[model samples]
Target: MIAVNGRDTEWREGLTIRIIMQENKYTSPRIVIKVNGHVVRQEQWESYAVQDGDDVLVLHLIAGG
Candidate 1:
């Protein structure tokens, strides 16, 4: 199991950042993903693999005037 935005989510092998986002229906264009306290590069989302018991934080960036 893994903690995604404070909620417990099922963990599986070969799970990448992209897969996690897809599974959680996270489609925000300006999304920031952090795993185990480490920031994951946007370009690496498709290939960044998260492990079991990992804490994943997904935040949507907002811009205001």
Candidate 2:
């Protein structure tokens, strides 16, 4: 199992940052993702693997004018 935004989720064999984002419906382009407290770059999302029991945090930045 993996923890995403403090919620438990089933761990998958081929789980990646991109997959997690899609699963959680994080469609915002201005967002940051962290795995185990480490930031995952946008370009590395596809290659960044999410392991079992990992803690993932997705935060979107909102702008106000």
Candidate 3:
């Protein structure tokens, strides 16, 4: 199991940041993802693996006029 955005989620082998985004339906253009307090680069999202008991934080950046 893993903690995503303070919510418990099922853990799976070979799970990457990209997969997590898809699973949670996170499609914000300004979203930022960090695992264990380290930032995950956009290019590495597909390769950055998320392990069990990890704390994943997804921050959504917003702008207004």
Best by lDDT: 3
lDDT of 2 by residue, 1-65 (tens): 99989999999899999998888888888989999999998999998989999999888899998
Predicted candidate 1 versus true structure: per-residue lDDT over 1-65, tens digit per residue? 99999999999999999999888898887998889889998899998888999999998989986
Worst 10 residues of 1 by lDDT: 20-29
TM-score, cand. 1: 0.92
Tell me each candidate's RMSD, in Å, in order: 0.9, 1.0, 1.1
lDDT of 3 by residue, 1-65 (tens): 99999999999999999999998899876888899999988889889999999999999988987
Clashing residue pairs, candidate 2?
none
Q: Model 3, which residues run further than 4 Å from truth?
A: none
Q: Which of candidates 2 and 3 is the stronger one according to lDDT?
A: 3
Candidate 2 vs candidate 3: the TM-score winner is 2
How far off is residue 28 in model 1, in Å?
1.6
